[model samples]
Target: MLEQYVRKILTARVYDVAEETPLQSAYQLSQRLGNSILLKREDLQPVFSFKIRGAYNKIAQLSEAEKARGVVTASAGNHAQGVALAAKHLGIKATIVMPKTTPEIKVKAVRARGARVVLHGDAFPESLAHSLRLVEEKGFVYIHPYDDPDVIAGQGTVAMEILRQHQGALHAVFVPCGGGGLIAGVAAYIKYVRPEIKVIGVEPEDSNCLQAAMAAGERVSLPQVGLFADGVAVSQIGEHTFAVCRDYVDEVITVSSDEICAAMKDIYDDTRSITEPSGALAVAGIKKYVARSAIKDQNLVAIDSGANVNFDRLRHVAERAELGEQREAIIAVTIPENPGSFKRFCEAIGKRQITEFNYRFHSKEQAHIFVGVQTHPELDPRSELLKQLDEAGFPVIDLTENELAKLHIRHMVGGHNDAVINERLYRFEFPERPGALFNFLNKLGGHWNISMFHYRNHGAAEGRVLAALQVPDDEMHLVPEAFNSIGYPYWDETDNPAYKLFLAQ
Candidate 1:
């Protein structure tokens, strides 16, 4: 079977549409990991993905009769673009059935390639079912995204290019696994040509079809799949692809969504190019492998599969990147509720950057503060920070790995605090510097109780803060005077409808 795949890969006709992407060296990642890291730039294909290789190969080899009958396929992402472009190049009528929920940009891209677009259900499965129906009704040849032998063979060409590009002492190659087609193809080719090199597969933890199949010793379907890395979000591995992978692939690694975000940032920092979550899987897997094995001075390769990410998703990616890299620590700390306690806590925290700060005056004895602090993976780890906080007599709860805290709790920290009375909410913009929060707290002083406070560093020139202070009715006139003395831009949000609806006491 391996030999047959090897022969097909060598003769694969993908070049008519897909270009041989470069295996570029990742300098910063190499230096950080102590390994020679290289990235297979499959994201640079004409359709901005490796799916083009397989799609073109499958369509180009069809019989004249089949071509005349036309082709149909279902995809909500890169595969849709790949099939559309390939069929257009081959002068064959291609009908692409995509989920109605798919981004308009993607639908436009397929239609731009001259494929008749059929917007079906809200998800891929529904689109796939509709496409199959079209195949039977219209006599259209259905193009399997990752299951067909021709498709797998075309994807194998990626491994062929890698071996030819860098004919050296390669240790292992990391490939992102979806329906297993890309890895199956690359694994078969590599195992046949250079059996010494390990072919490792990477998958999102929530969408690990290959790993589950390998464990079950057969194809096992997941009840549901995660859509974060939508390109590789397969519930079950393809039968043909899995057959090849079961023997050829060495190991599979699963990574969290945060790790994928971190890997995407790493790719962007090195290549100045962004990748979709799935495209960063191989890189994320390589990071975990290096950390686990502690291997050094070995050649590692990561397949960057695609670059079809939406623009709005970058905010979420950036927010989680530091945490994924173990460079940020989130903790809930208990401090004294007395005046100047915020300043004291900052002093205990030392000079390390505070990424986030949230506090609400709940009791006179103690205060709960949700804080995000920056830490280095090697020099000043999260454990050391926790130790420092403990030594300072500050009770702390590590929320670094708490998905609930990270995703929702952080934003919902201070809402409708009935204990907060006579609260005057004010929004401030302070100079974004190391001691800015401490300085602001010091100026605000022990005069009044701080009812609610929130500060998040957004890497902007100025840090945005929302704080509410408790003051007597007579001291209302002094509020503006105190803020003016602090010398920072401020706005009174006491009557802001959003505050009244969500947070007013």
Candidate 2:
């Protein structure tokens, strides 16, 4: 079965538009990790992603009758552009169905590639359902993003290119896994040709379909996927891709969102390229793998998959990268409200640059300061600094690894305590669309009074809401039912340390 895929990959017709991207050296990262690192620059494609290779390959094999009918596919981002570009080149009409929650930048990009864009569904699964309907109704050929044999074979060309580019003894190759198309293709080819070179699949911890599939010994559908790495936010692994990975891929590494952001910064620092979160998955995996094994002095390669990032998303990446890499530490310190107390605290911090500092006069005796302190990558300097403050009888809380504090509470301080009773806080994530908030309120807020609300758009597929509600003891039991009826996943943030410190009742 694997040998058949190897032969097909060798003959995949992708060079018509997809160029063989360079496998360049990442010297800075190599030096840091004590290993020679090579980055497979798939982001350099004309379509700015590796999807073009697979999309074109699948469409190129179409019969004349199929070409006449044209092609249709559902994708929220890169795959849509790939199919559109391929369709344009072959003079075949293409229609792309995308989630309405897809960023405007991506929607515009698909249209620019000469494809008719259909905005439907709030998420990928919904868009996929709509696209499948088009296939039955209009008789259009559906170019699946990753599952098809031809698509997997086309993506396998990446491995072919990598083997040809480097003649050295390669230790391992890391590929980012979404629907598992790229890794399946790459693994099929690599395992056949260079069996010793491990092909590791990398995924976001929240969207780890490949990992789950491997563990279950079958394809498993995830209940939900993280949107931060939108490119690889797939809930289920493709059946064909999973079969290849299970037999060929060595391991699947899952990294946190912050780790991905840190990897993005690393890529930017080494090659001056800012990759999307999914694109940086392999890099993040490499760092995690090296940390796990403490492996060094070997040649490791990572596929830098795509670069189609929205301009506005960079700000969030920049803010989180330092913390992701442990180059900065966020600490909440409580010091006396006296004038000399501020000076004493600053003196203890020494010469390290303060990334952020926020404080407000809460009382006459004490004030809480949300501080960001710079630290080295090798050692956590926050520990020693924290000890000094603790010995001096200052209260401190390390907010470095706190997700809630990082996401919502950091931006929210100094607005706590109210006359309104039973202030229950819940963090809600809902599909962002017109009147989404109105719908949320109408569905879940008629019986309860909203006490506090905080929302800021990140220009992604979903919106996050942090709200305080006044729910009586009797109504507390109904809270779960109300949220269930509303159909949005939520976390009770009322007991969170940051909430307790800053805004709890």
Candidate 3:
């Protein structure tokens, strides 16, 4: 079976569209980590992703009749672009079913490649179901994003290039795992050719399909997947890929969304390339691995798989990168209402730069403040800083590791209304522009009184708003109307666990 796959990978005709991207050295990252770090620059491919290799290989292997009949596939974004570009090159009509929740930039990219675009459900699973129907009804050949043997074989070409480019004493290659296509293919090739070189798989903790499959000893469906790394937000690993991973892959490692953001910054510092969240997964894994293990002064390789990132999303990434790298520490502090309390807090902080500060006067007795302080990235300063604050008699709560504190509560601090009846809190995302906040309030504020509101501009294209509205249970119908009329995306936080624990009355 492995020999057959080797044949398929060797014969894959991907160069008609895909490029043999370079394996570039990340000098800055290497220096910082105290290890030689090489980045497999798959992000430089024609579609800004290695997906074109698999997509083009699958399409090229098709019979002339099959090509004429056309192909259909469901994708979140990167694979759609790949299939679209491959179809365009082959002069084959392609129908791409993509999630409605896919970024507008990615959707437009697929359409620009001259494919027939169909916006289906909100995620890959639903889009897959819709595409399968098209395959059955329209007589279109289905080019699955990652499952098929041909696609996996095509993806192996990346490992082939990696070996040829770097002939040094290679320690390990970290491949970002999604549905397991890339890692499976790379592992198969590397393990066959160079058995000593470890093939590690990296995945986002929330969407670790490959890791979960390996643990189960078979392919298993995830109940849900996080959309932060939308490119690799697969619910399950493909059967073929899972088999390959089970046999050839050494181990799988998971990293968080914040770590991925920091990896993006690291890649940018070295390669000047802004990678998508999933694209930076391997880099994040490398950082985590270095910190966890004694491996040092050794050669490490990470597959920087794609760069099809939404420009607006970078704002959020930039905001979280510092925290992920441990360069910033967030803490909740309580100070007296007296005039010299803030001065005393500043003196305690010493010379460390404050990244952010949020405070509201809740009572005459005390005031709570959300503070972000810069610190050494490699070392955690939370404990020492908290100790200092404790010794100084200032109360402190470490909000750095708190998810709810970082995402929602930091913005929603104070202004809790016990007087307002039937108050429903909502978290909303609106297109960021001049007067976006005013427009949101004006459009949604019909007779429902806005009892509480909290918003802070992170300079992203979307503005997140936490709002509490006063409306009676009998007038619940007005809530939907307000949302529909506002035309901004909103999620009810009235019963949100975080809201209940932190902000709700």
Candidate 4:
């Protein structure tokens, strides 16, 4: 069988190539999973990925004539760097055609390794097509990212290392699946060496090409690929890689983008290394599988595949991580548009910090406001808060359950209020501890009324409170003076662009 041949090659070549990555036991994950859990640290490889092993092995196995002719490949990021560095080591010319949207860091890394870089097309498929055309035009050898046997055998080395390190004690291995190359290689080697060790492939639910292909009994193409996990956002699995996966992989599971982000954050918290969403797949998969299967006493291994993520993207990851874990909730509360009704609602939410508050008074009949609240980690407090709101006769809609809340409504809050003729907007920088906002509210005295307010507690040096205060026309200048007396820096929003933009909306 092909598994035997793959094992033989993996044992001989892959071990010789990528022998340095560690199979480190994760103390945090093992405790959480209720069994021994180990992380195969492929992210620690020189290229920050396992791609170099496959790319180098594939290039090395090519004939002397092929090496003389040079090679060309297409990748969104990591694979391009791998092939570029490998070709540079072999002293052969290499061309990498990448998507125009590829991160600047990746493009620079590929060029630094002496590969000619071409930015073509909007996505990976178009870049792959362009690379194929280049191969035809320039007569350079085409090195596929995952399809070839040499590449599969090279990736098999990861499984070889895991087996050698764990010595057959592992119950299951979680591998991230893209074009199916990584899982295919790992599954083939593990099934050959230790048939009892289950090999499972993890994929983003948005791009489960392998799962769909397995069900259809043929290679299947998704209509669209999600770019969030650009590393493994392949639309279709390769034929050879799919065959290996079908034969050896025990099961394929899918996880959400939020889950992937949370998993990536977990990995970062434990290892202090940022993992790309694709790299976090194995961790996300294990989480999903454990939750669904209710298996508490089984040893598992999750492969931490790559760490080539853009630093700026971490903001988005952190934002969604809580949502993935169900720690933070976005909700809307419909309160009576009266004077103390808002205050009563605020009082009802004792101790719970309001992450966001958006209000609009459409007419005298109704006042609708969307609120996002951050609760304690245990969601029981949220449940109690909800019950209290219900008892107070306020209609609450859990915007956390609404897609619009998650995507747009939470950010789109402030708007112009023509009725606020006597009101002024002020931006206050205050400390983020509990009761800070309430303390500021209490200090306002009976003279000023809060007509509108927006505040979200981000763990920063300080908390920003955007509030619209309605005071007597004569008392307008007292706003800043009062805040300054209390040691709070206040900025008038009359000339601020962000204030105007929010108000104009």
Candidate 5:
């Protein structure tokens, strides 16, 4: 089985459209991990993903009659781009059926390559079904994204390049897994050539089709997959790909969404390049493996699979990266409502940089504060911080691992307080800088009671804040004048429907 794949991979005609992307050294990651870390830069391919290698290889090998009939496939994004570009190169009319939920940028990318784009149902399964129907109706060949033997052989070229590029000591190669195509191809080639070097597959925990299959000893479909790592959000492993992976692959590692984000940041820090969440899976797995096995001084390679992530998604990635790395701790601490109590709590926290702070005056006796503090996994761990706060007589609830607290509670800490009467909500945008919030608050003059406040720093040029001030109906006209004096751009959100539903009285 492996011999056949090895032969096909050796003669795979992927270079026609895909580049032999460099296996670049991850210098920073190497130093930190105490191992020589190499990144297989598949993100540098023509389609910005390794999917092109298989897509082009399969399409190019078709008979003249099949080429004339054209080809069709379904993809959420990355594979669609690869098929579109490969067909255009061969002068074949290609039709790509993509989920309606696919990003417009990807839809445009496919169309840009002169492929007809059919925006179908809400997800890949739906679109895939539609593409198969097109295959039967139009007599066009359907290019399977991962299941085909030729496609698997095409992806095997990645492992071929890795072995040739670094003919030195290599402990393992981490491949990101979706439908098992890349891992299947990579594992087959590596085991046949360098059996000593481990072939490990990395997957998102919530979307781990390959890992699930390995456990089941057969292909198994997940009820649903998380869309965070959308590129690898496959529900089932490909049948052909799984057959190779089940035997050839040594191990499969799963990483969480937060870990994936941290790996993305780590890759960016080393290479100054951004990769999609799925692209960073191998690195995340490497981190988990190293931490678990306590391995050191070995050569490990991680496949930086693709860079098709949307720019807007970076904000969420940035926010979660710290928490994923165990570098940030979120806690809800109860402090006395006395004037100097907040100051005393700050003194207790001591020297640590506060990433965020949210407080509300729920009662006259005590206040619940949601705070984010910088922590290190080794030096100043969350346990130590909790100990210190406890020693200082501050009752704290560690919300670091609380999903509800991190996702929604942090933002909705002080919402719709009946006691916060005569409240007028205003959203403010100020230049982000040290003491900017302090200055803004100082300018407010402390005339009216600040009933509610919400602020989160997103590492942006501008700092946005949502705050409500208690102002009588008669004094409402003076609110805009006071904001004008503050000189920050402000919006009246008191009447905003979202505010009314969630935060307003």
Candidate 6:
């Protein structure tokens, strides 16, 4: 049935789109899983996604009278670009309705494709309703992004290419699920050709409409959708696509946002390609299922569905990648307030490298310190570190699991000091080479006490250092010259905007 529909659409459309994408083998993933792993590179398509195939096919199949009436669509990101580009290629006027909060980059890309972009509502459903209203009022053809027969048929071309490229060696195929168009098409074709090959559907655990619908044995709407994987953040699967998925897909898996970030990094490290969180879903699901089922020495294929990620989000992905692997720990340790107590606490930590340290001398009797430590994989080093501190007669609290400690305490340390003393904060920029920070610490005059300091080597040529010092009120003016003479650029907190903001809070 799907093949017949695909043939009909191919015959109706004058444009050719079959020769663009490639099916590439993933060497790193295959070795890691002990299986022959292949990647269907729909990400390499002209629009950087498989959505174009379906969008173009659907629009091409319209009757001549319908084509003259123009087109309208509602999409969050990738699909919007697909529709806009397809309309431009076919010489059809298209109006795309997108959420107001859609990324600026996506909105610009849609406009660049010669489509009139309308920012409406706060979510896809609301924008979709608005688009439908425009279709009715202007007599425009509403091009359903995923629910039509032509769209599903066009998407099935991915499966056809996969079969030709891999030659039936696949034991399982993983596809990310949003509104289920891509998965529905792929599963229908793969099941028809290779009934033994398992068809797995993947979804973000936070917005898992397909998984929930399959469990209930019927379509169900999600109460809320997660925007982290914005490309696949669908609240409900389409009726036509869900019908194909219900009959063809063998299993469905849900992956967390952290897991998706890890997968995105993995793909970048292996293939040097940046994939959006949605594109990484298939790879994440395959890795998760292989570990869960202990499947070894089998063939696997993961469809890299799209690569339309915003570059600004990469920083957040990099920050959370290590935590996903359990290779780092953030904790708070309290030590004695006496002289040499800090040295003893450092000694107790032994061989662990301190990634971050923030502290304040609270009272004459106690000091609070927040520290982040690098730990061996597969072990909670916090318990052992705490035990050693306790044995050394220091009161230690494990703030490893404290959300507040992880988010805020590390950055705001010096505010807890006594008001009797005068403290000055300075921002210092210095070279990032080894021991540069230590050298700055060593140059501090003995009379001036170090109150608080925070520095991180961000893999840049230069490093930023924020330090607070407690000194006699008369010595405050001399501190800037002290840093300047040492060839370090420094800014006093009195005139720093960040300090004013923090003080205001």
Looking at model 3, report the run of 10 residues with the lowest lDDT sum: 496-505
Q: Assess each prediction's global lDDT (C-alpha) against the native.
A: 0.89, 0.90, 0.85, 0.77, 0.87, 0.76
Error of 3 at 467 (Å): 5.9
Residue 86 Cα positional deviation in candidate 6, in Å, after optimal superposition = 0.9
Measured by TM-score, how close is model 2 to the native structure? Answer: 0.97
Q: TM-scores across all candidates?
A: 0.83, 0.97, 0.87, 0.79, 0.83, 0.75
How good is model 6 by TM-score? 0.75
Give the runs in model 3 whose Cα sits over 4 Å from its true position.
421-505
Quote the positional error of residue 55 for candidate 2 in Å.
0.5
Off by over 4 Å in 1: 415-505
Error of 5 at 334 (Å): 1.0
- Please give the lDDT score for candidate 5: 0.87
Pick the winner on TM-score between candidates 1 and 4.
1
Q: After superposing candidate 2, which stretches have Cα over 4 Å from the reference?
A: none
lDDT of 3 at 181: 86
Q: Look at candidate 1 and tell me the lDDT of residue 336.
A: 83
Tens digits of per-residue lDDT for model 1 on 62-92?
A: 9999999999999988899999999999999
lDDT of each residue in 1-505, candidate 5, tens digit only: 9999999999999998899999999999899888889999999988899999999999999999999999999996688999999999999999999877566788899999999999887556789999999998999999998999999999999999999999999999999999988999999999999999999999998888888988989889997676678888889999899889999899999999889999999999999999999999999999999999989999999999999888877987998999999999988888888889988999999999999998766568876788999999998999999999999999888888765456545688663567668888777777555677898887864668887777776443346777878899998888877888887777777774434434566
Q: Write the per-residue lDDT of candidate 2 for residues 98-137, one digit (tens) a residue.
A: 9887778888999998999999987778999999999999
Best by lDDT: 2
Question: For model 3, how does the per-residue alpha-carbon lDDT over 1-505 read when each residue is reduced to its tens digit?
Answer: 7788878888989998899898899999998888999999999999999999999999998999999999999886789999999999999999999866566777889999999999887446788999999988999999988888889989999999999999889999999999888988898888888989999999999899888988989889997677678788888899889888998999999999899999999999998889988999999999999988968899999999999887878888998999889888988787898999999999999888898888777569887777899988546476788888889999887878766567778666663456767888887877555666887888777668887777876543356788888889999987787687776667776875445534666
> Residue 26 in model 2: shift from native, Å?
1.3
